[model samples]
Target chain A: MTAEEWEDFRKGHPKAASLKTVPLPFPELCATLFDGNAATGNPSQCLKLQHSAVIRIQTSRTLEEPKEDNMAKFSIATVFIASISLLLTLTHSFSLENPTDRRILVLVDDLALKSSHSIFFSSLQARGFELDFKLSDDPKIALQRYGQHLYDGLILFSPSTERFGGSLDVAAILDFVDSGKDLIVAADANASDLIRNIAAECGIDFDEDPSAVVIDHGSYAVSETEGDHTLIAADDFIQSDVLLGSTKIEAPVLFKGIGHSLNPANSLVLKVLSGSPSAYSANPKSKLSSPPSLSGSSISLVSVVQARNNARIVFSGSLDLFSNKFFKSTVQKAGSSHKFAKSGNQQFATEISKWVFHERGHLKAVNVRHHRVGETDEPAIYRINDDLEYLVEIYEWSGSNWEPYVANDVQVQFYMMSPYVLKTMSNNKKGLYLASFKVPDVYGVFQFKVEYQRLGYTSLSLAKQIPVRPFRHNEYERFIPTAFPYYGASFSTMAGFLIFSFVYLYSK
Target chain B: MGRSPTTKDDAQALFQSLRSAYAATPTNLKIIDLYVVFAVSTAVIQVVYMAIVGSFPFNSFLSGVLSCVGTAVLAVCLRIQVNKENKEFKDLPPERAFADFVLCNLVLHLVIMNFLG
Candidate 1:
């Protein structure tokens, strides 16, 4: 009936005292408390009392008397409760549940940057990221507290701070990166040695001359005053649509920063924006001293590293590259007359920020499964030369909702000491990647390895250990037709032996 | 290279002389010779068969050929021991030699059966 009548009926019952005092011991009874109709709010108070009255009788009869009528009702109630929770979990599973970066700690050299770079900061905020801005020398600053990382990503815009304030240091930041946390580092003309060391650890070498800035005489942006040619209109960007969004950046970006060179030994690091062929890194104020160490297109203005653990980091030579001034500026290259209303700085910064924060180009492989061709369940060990199929669901986090990652380049390796079978997997365009191959004839412990490292996407390295065994004694074929002659020959020799012995012994 | 007909004549003369000399061979020795030839021919047949077919069942091939060759070798040893002309094994009793031959044949056949797979 109504909640008031249900409550009154429960209180009027003779066993109402025990029902009120006794706790709901079984989980089945506990579920009634949640049936407060989650769709509508707080009527569950009276609704719980009403539902519990029915559940109480069901439990009492089943525990003591075992009546069929109440047992049936109790069973139906259990099904209802299970469906409710199943629906809850099903909806949760469909939500964006991947490793998209959420919390970030932004360390700034000065408080003025918070206002100067508010446009870029607001964009990050609008994208549902929680940014924690603090001065570099804040004594209480910490990347971690009590062995728990405070943020999923770190932004170091404090290039001039010689040393980080509290527990944040070179080793702590590197450890954060090693733990698969993302980072963003921006350095400028006055970049301290501490900032250089941090960049060096990430396989980059900034210009040794502290005062040097990238000077491109050929493509310097035309300003109101003819300033030094350090402010270049650089249009050289990496040709990855995934790294830089699919929309081509037409206008050259205004860049005023020092340049760095990526170490050749580090394959993980790549230059996102490089200087035009005529650009060089040298002190704009001083006369030409021994040809500039970093010159031409080799000078990297912006670089990104995807570490082995898939921790992405963006290293820009200019902090102003992320400032509102550059994002709002109109630009014209010196020689050419084509001027744009806005620079490409904002688009570049936003897309790179998305990359660094794992919004775009993040890949995850799930449900790695392998079984025999005819079977559905995975076996503990495989016999040598068994034809089997391997399947994995690979979905790229499309900077958005989880959609199917359709690519033909993914490969699976049946690896022992070396790869025995390396096959490119076929996909269904709906995220299911599969390959069928025969187990190697040789038997040993082997691994199903997927090492996917593409240019812009986060690499997916997965290995599942599987053991291969040679055939058991009875598993071998009992009678082969080709060996029949051998069997015949052997038997004939035995018969000959018998006859020869008989003739030899009975000769006398 | 041009002496084909003359070589055939020479081979026929060699065969004639050998048959004349072997005619005086003891009857029991002739029986042993027949048994040895049987085993040797069986082994040769198996080798030819293996050449035609691939050696896929290698263990079976080895066991088959070895059993026949081994029986022929043992039969020859028995013949030498029992022969009156073979002075090398003269002191070896024919009974002991025959017993040795039977035992060796049993062991060889056992091994062949085990490897026949």
Candidate 2:
């Protein structure tokens, strides 16, 4: 048929036109054809099959038409592609409202390290993370393609690589973090300058002596070789349930790498693991040089930083901490008879990975609402001495899902120039936190602020401004009985004037 | 500090002269003076009551004291206009003064009633 004739035919038969546009499943199409043919009573089964056959034939014929039909077909194809791209863009946007990152990119120096660290990698995979392992020097590797990040997190295990390929540099890695992505960096003894620079950017300074390794002669793990006291056993972990799992780690962790010190000015960086008081960083092969630069509790074995944007990062001085060998190795600290069959590396690695991947400590607060007591609708402004209740729903991302975050320290402040009402909120065990307090007996522009910062959770800072007004003139109580004497005196004065007036004018 | 009969005689003479002068005043003026004295004493009594009972109802205290003070003032104005010896208000009539006093008292009572609460 000609194009005009086909258009007219489609308009005349509305049912056929709709069927052509919306491709239905076979069974549903059969049902629809059967229903349509039921009224005619003309052998419905045969008619249903015949209708579907006719539609297939018409669609095929339309596709094989001349170039004159290309305009309409091209527009339809373009619309379909556009809608799919829009849907993908919507899913790719990073937002704290949904604190789950699905994809990760792991960079390693050698392919053999992948097998050595398979325990750590498998743990991440079992948690629903799509890990893409690539060599650090791969020329085609790129963090973003066409202004879209391919992964939500980056793991740097290539401590020896001097430089990265493609557009990946220290700045590019920092840019990824600035866009609210997580990072986990592992460096070893004699780490390359590039890795040291990245650690420096995160407010950590590695020991300047390249040969220096963290040596704890007093707390060194008892090994069979009895070599230089370079292998230290670290038991001083940060006392935080969120960073480390709730189950206490009984065995000390094994460390055989360089040590770092945190920058005093950077408050965001926290020393998650520290060396023993007898531990010091000095050249293991050479004699004792000038005093060690990093010693005692100042040497941080592992540190974590939660950036202002909530992009978490973990820096470990030893890449072997994540290795399966270290995880399975037995550890017995010097002068201690308690021998652990398995080191604490596995649990420590898993918990720190969970934290860095935005799975443990990420918090999201939503539906912040406040209204007067016994009222449902929020008011634009409040009056002084008003009894109000504030509510907020907070959830923590537990690797795979949002779970209720329960804590007793969440507080809300009714603040103008200063806090007028500071009350600790009560929770309903279902993620809803509520506080009921009377608005202070002062009127001004005030804000309902909740600044909740826990030990390891992401800070929840919320402030909503509202105005408070004084009572209107007509709203005041009138003619109180306590002032009846004053009222009587005033009225009697008026009466006295009237009586005195009459007497003075009439008495003659 | 010597005990002298001259000092006692001087004080007695002063009281006698003051009584003689006050007795010469007109009866109507004297009646107005007595009314002023009554209002002033009532105001003093209210002040002492506030000092003892505390000014918890400050607006009531203010209205009570102001009413008595206002009455004393109006009565004094009436006394001045009807004295027949005060030359400043000789042209002004006592009835006119009483009318003004009644109007002022009415306005004062109206405000006090509103503020009493």
Candidate 3:
């Protein structure tokens, strides 16, 4: 249309006419281009300019492209693929929902341990771990930044680094685990005070003598080159499939380092691997002195602490537990003839890592509902003496799927000052548990409570408070059988009054 | 029996004069007084019965006692208005007083009956 005709159209429909407009020829060309039909007419000067505009854009984008029959693009494509694959591998190393010491930050006093302990480092890498080896004195070994965590797990391999460099210290490590992370701490003959302090906070006390190494003469892994027999073989692990996995350990765990005593006051910590009755912690190289402070079964070879916040920490007296030499070494316990092909380090580390990473011991409760019998909707308030049925569905996270949490000890309480009715709930095997009961006759305020604490599982404490009210004045029973005598007396008195009035009027 | 004849004669004469004065009252007022006495006696009997039986139905006991007491009060009001010797109530007619007494009794009995149960 002509410009004057378009202006006239705009005047007639002002609301629609306010939108932007393009020239007729340009719109016609766009319609043709969108339809994929090239204009057939002689090439106009404007069409040529549009063609050059499209060509200029394409040429500029491909200007840096190598002219090797698309081999350059193939290389770039491979680079993109490799970058994505690397990212996937890195993320798979450390995890939140499942625990693993995959992407570990190995702090060391000297860089020599990287090569000297290459067996340990290589074993870790072979097991799909990305070990970021940093000298303990590195100025950039920060565990967190601005209250945001940087790692899902931490490993302190530096036993003698007196004080960590940068912002990392005892408090930073503790704060990491406090926020529900995993940790593996290994201390040797001369562990730093900072490491000891961290261990003490988790209810473990390393050997007081800075030079003491756990010397087990009676239970050491029998070797041809045995000197002090301090290299012990421990087979007595804590018997728990949930904690250590269902597979039994066939070989004994080899330990050779300082022993620690778990603090009696800390109940959350447990000794997974305990010292044999004959074992004692005293520097074997030094001459005998007074009785050792830590001896006998009180000394824990390897202990684990599952904090109240579900942070899993494994504290080992020996860094050799992670070494490939120990994992692959043949072991024969002292005074025993049965020889094993390999030690228990590999299986023990892998199973414990799965547990610490939240692949186990994670629970979630949902679908909590309560109502009177035969009712679907939960009421805001319940009347005293109401027959109520409370239902709660509890499921545990089985790494990938939710499974029914089953236990006979799960109980429900109808609580007012204390529980008036404590009943063991019955489950339907599908995780839906129901506790049916009559509301107490006494009314004020009441609560439904469930406190489930199992041996190895995380404790579940849940309570829902709901008020119970007495019946209203009109709502009371209109005629109760028990109250019939009282009613009879009232009516008889009125009848007697009527009769007495008649008798008095006539007799007088 | 052993007193002097003159002292005995004086006591007898005093009681005889009091009896004659009471006998001079109107028959309608005397009837009202008899009704009041009946109501009061009924109230006393009920109270004694409640004490022996135990007040398990306390509401019934209250209604029974109040009914008797209310009747006696209404009868007393009737007697006062109808008595010719009472000059202050001379404007009040005996029929009007009886009608008021009957109306008040109706109201009191209604409340007592409701409270009885």
**Candidate number of the best DockQ:** 1
Task: Give the TM-score of each candidate.
Answer: 0.80, 0.79, 0.65
lDDT of 2 by residue, A342-446 (tens): 999999999888888877888989999999999989999998888999999999988767999998889999998899999999999999999999988899999
Docking class of 3: incorrect
Residues A365-449, candidate 3: write the lDDT tens digits.
6788899999999999999899999989988767666789886668999998899999999999988899999999888889999
lDDT of candidate 3?
Answer: 0.77
**lDDT per residue (tens digit) for residues A1-508 in model 1:** 4667656867776455354445545434444555545334444354455456666777877777657767889999999999999878545422336567778899999989999999999999999888999999999889888786778899999989998899989999999999889999999999999999999999999999898899988999998999889898999999998899889999889899999999999999999999999999999999996899999999999999999888999999999999999999999988999999999999999999988888888888889999999999999999999999999999888756767899999999999989999999999999999999999899999999999999999888999999999988677675789989988999999998898889878987
Which CAPRI level is candidate 1?
A: medium
Best by TM-score: 1
lDDT of the candidates, in the order given: 0.89, 0.86, 0.77
Flag the better candidate by lDDT, 1 or 2. Answer: 1
Instruction: Quote the lDDT for A362 in model 2.
Output: 89
Weakest ten-residue segment in model 2 chain A by summed lDDT: A39-48
Candidates by TM-score, descending order? 1, 2, 3
